[model samples]
Target: MTLTKSTFTGLVLEYDSGIVPPPYSHVFRLALDWSKGDMIADLVLHYTEREDLSEEEILDEGFTLNDDYNYQGPLNSVWIKPLQQLYEKTRWTNKDIEEGGITVTPLEKGKDEGVKIPSDQEEWQLMAQDLIQAIYETVKKEAPLKVNYRSVQGDEIIDCSLTVHFSNREVIFEIAGKSRQINWEYAIQLMKIVFTPDYHYELAKEEAGKKRGAYIDCGDGFWHELGKGVVNIDPSFDAVSKIRKGFDELISE
Candidate 1:
């Protein structure tokens, strides 16, 4: 028999988390299929976070698989070995394949049009390294300084200070006299969204005839906005541009 690789995207694997109180449910992605029987299947898993859930709610609700797509197949017993191999090769802990339901459907016709899955831990590390390097280069021009900005917190204008230290891979932000250290990867992503040409233009236009600050929610638990007379060497802008460039290069590779 000829071994072939059948790649599936958007496959949801649902299982029981073995938790009481609400009987927590868990979901994972089976992105690839590599089997040695009739067909070999390799699994690529995706990670997700429920933004609508609070910490306690998430713990109670358990894990949830994406229900956007569905899969249908006659799961053969011969495929069990391959699935077990996959479990050992990756981060998946449980071996209860029978308990976890797997669905396979045609989500993408070509590789180019495939779904944009979440980055794996390895990929995240590489991206983090690139972001740290880029931020380091950008911050070198002005070391040990703080930039001020205005942000809206519950309908109030608040002052925020961004401090970049050359020795660390984190950006320090002081809001309401409380300091938080945001990692380079997260800060880069936030800046990319806020500093985009369209978003920046819109912010400028909206603030042209208004007193309210133009703010964008970073979605990482912080709101960033431009302050009056902020300097030309804004770290956010520099880091965002570098991140965009790095991402483009990564994709091309």
Candidate 2:
């Protein structure tokens, strides 16, 4: 799968949430726009269980409970949105699967001459958008269940809704408005190698006495060129803690 900026943002958000889980039954969900990426982080409270308190009162109590945590901002920004209490939904996904779609004839690559690769930034951006669309279509058609994923990158990436596809054995993320798939296995493996329990994620080869991009830092920094190719193309240092947590949830599900 090709990793795009749009999808990258949600991965960031999810990673953030994992590093810090919600207070009890409370969960933080990021909002997404098809064109804008993520507009706000929504606070979903388990109101059904907290019947004794009013929403406003409950929120006030929570802030008093954890002063260090920030959600609502003084500036009233994208990082902060009004609190929303939502009830549990039923029948969003199906348990039983194995139903296939209509079989269609396959189309081979064009017989036309050699393709020209994009060398300019503008050309690459245009191509990235197209690639994102293609990945989205592939997942929508092939995967039985798809769900929305949000961002921890805050305003770093463009606003778009990202998605993940789940099967029995593994999971894949296409993400947001411009879809792109990445090598999920390779990404997880790389994350594991670089992740440290005490200090969290690192993008450096400490033994080498120098820092490097995560993609190349591992192997010859002893990184091998083998096995299904590269993952964590450019992971932000210290992000693996939360990102890996989110990854675990998806795989477990």
Model 2 poorest 10 in a row by lDDT: 82-91
lDDT of 2 at 203: 36
Report the CA-based lDDT of candidate 1 relative to the real structure.
Answer: 0.37
TM-score of 2: 0.19
lDDT of candidate 1 over 10-75, digit per residue (tens): 122222222322223334333322222332222222333345556666545554344122232323
Off by over 4 Å in 1: 1-148, 152-155, 164-167, 199-210, 215-253
Q: After superposition, how far is residue 147 of candidate 2 from its true place, in Å?
A: 30
Q: What is the C-alpha lDDT of each candidate?
A: 0.37, 0.28
TM-score per prediction, in order, is 0.27, 0.19
Query: Candidate 2's residue-wise lDDT over 1-253, tens digit each?
Result: 3323322222111111122223333322222222233332222222123445555765765533332222321112222121110001111122321221111111112122222222232332322222223333333533333322222233332122123222211334443334445454444443444433222124333332212211122322322111112234445644444443444443333
User: What's model 1's lDDT at 21?
Assistant: 26
How many clashing pairs in candidate 1? 11
